[model samples]
Target: MISRFSNVNRAYVNTVGISSVFNIGDSMQITPSIKVLAIQREQEIYYDEEGKFSQFPIFEEEIPQPVFYEQLTTNFFNKNPKINVDSISVTSISSSAILQIGSTKDIVCESRTKHIRQSKN
Candidate 1:
């Protein structure tokens, strides 16, 4: 299957990979996982109290002690009379950073839901 792990951008580092696939009835369950490692060249953007923004240097190879992990799961079904996305589940994992200088952790931000319709009447 085509996945994020296979088509990662060259500008950032990631450890996401597919862990397993299990067939249950007519639906298939997919498990996509991630492990934390520092993002290369991805800046930590910050906004101060006075409404000024600043860029902080995240040193090279500094593994992120991420405070939040977000995942988006999409269910797609074709326009057949009997098929539709029934449900989805997402999970994330993380570990403690050993060489980072700040107590501050990373925020993985995203909006979590979307919907599309395919119907035959």
Candidate 2:
């Protein structure tokens, strides 16, 4: 699981990379169900009292990201009738640092109204 922070110091989940599956002891194999979250930032366009259009930072609520699950192998389950399911091992890999977005232009605002409506609910 990798975490990223916005300019306002909001910590959000950026990515989840599963390199391998969890092994139930050295006998049985299992599947993985991963959940991820991400945030999309944008600018809100509105007219001021003076009738001049302006933009302001508006960040949408965190939403679920994509997760890829690998299929479990049936060979291991078939071989081991009495599976040793007491212990489990998780594989870990070196993760790279989080990259930050540069400026307000990077944030999209085309769907600002739609996001705002959703957030209220």
Candidate 3:
């Protein structure tokens, strides 16, 4: 049963030199899901009259870089010699299904919408 939808919340810049945040936990699935809750732009933050700001949609600017799950594994391992990641899952950007991430794979998503509304660069 899906509860809430939340996009992968982006955090600070990592060693790979990209901005990132923790994606919705693999185990969590809420129907009315909140895939991501990103902050709007600088000027819009001050003048958006629609109260859309209340929603606080995720902003592309806030997310400068998005390193894939595989990348994370390599980067994480390199930084902490003591830590060892084994498995990882990759998400399909075009899918609606929530992403499943492991220690050494990529995150994957089973998309709901057929036409990927998200802007792909």
Candidate 4:
């Protein structure tokens, strides 16, 4: 139950609090159910003088839309059949921005998928 919502540099979280470690280009599940969002992706194709295309694959990687609470609720429901995150939002808290691990924060293990939860309200 730490307040995830703040005016500056603080994020609003729904079920879970700020991730112990956040990073750019990292996929974080702010809640138990939210999944990755697919947004408009762009790529530049190389061309020859005669408009011939190159054989190399296009490079595309964008920082996804700043995670949203509504999207998180929807994903949470789809992932969990028993508990709905929507109900939790109605009662508990909703976050605005996700806490991303920056260069200033301490970095833990790189390749670990850890899930930490709060036991009390």
Local distance difference test values of all predictions, in order: 0.28, 0.29, 0.32, 0.28
For candidate 2, which ten residues in a row score worst on lDDT? Answer: 102-111
**Across residues 7-121, which tens digit of lDDT does each residue of candidate 4 receive?**
2233333453322232233242433222222222244433344222232122122324545667333222233222112211112222222334322222222111223232333
* Steric overlap count per candidate: 0, 0, 39, 6
Model 1 lDDT tens row, 11-120: 22133223322222222222233332222323454334422112222222345555757886877543432322334333421231111111212323221112223344
TM-scores for every predicted model? 0.16, 0.17, 0.18, 0.16
Find the 10 residues in a row with the least total lDDT in model 1.
1-10
lDDT of 3 at 87: 40
Estimate, for each residue in 92-111, the C-alpha lDDT of model 3 and write its tens digit.
32213332231223433221
- Report residue 83 deviation for candidate 3 (angstroms): 22
Error of 3 at 98 (Å): 2.3
**Superposition TM-score, candidate 1 onto the true structure:** 0.16
Kindly list the per-residue Cα lDDT of model 2 for residues 38-81, writing each as its tens digit. 22334444434522123223324444555779875543223333
Task: Please identify model 3 stretches exceeding 4 Å from their true place.
Answer: 1-29, 35-45, 53-85, 89-97, 101-121
- Backbone clash pairs in model 3 (N, Cα, C under 3 Å; residues 3+ apart or in different chains), count: 39
Best by lDDT: 3
Provide the RMSD of all predictions against the true structure, rounded to 1 decimal. 20.9, 18.4, 16.1, 20.4
lDDT ranking, high to low: 3, 2, 1, 4
Ranked candidates (TM-score, high to low): 3, 2, 4, 1
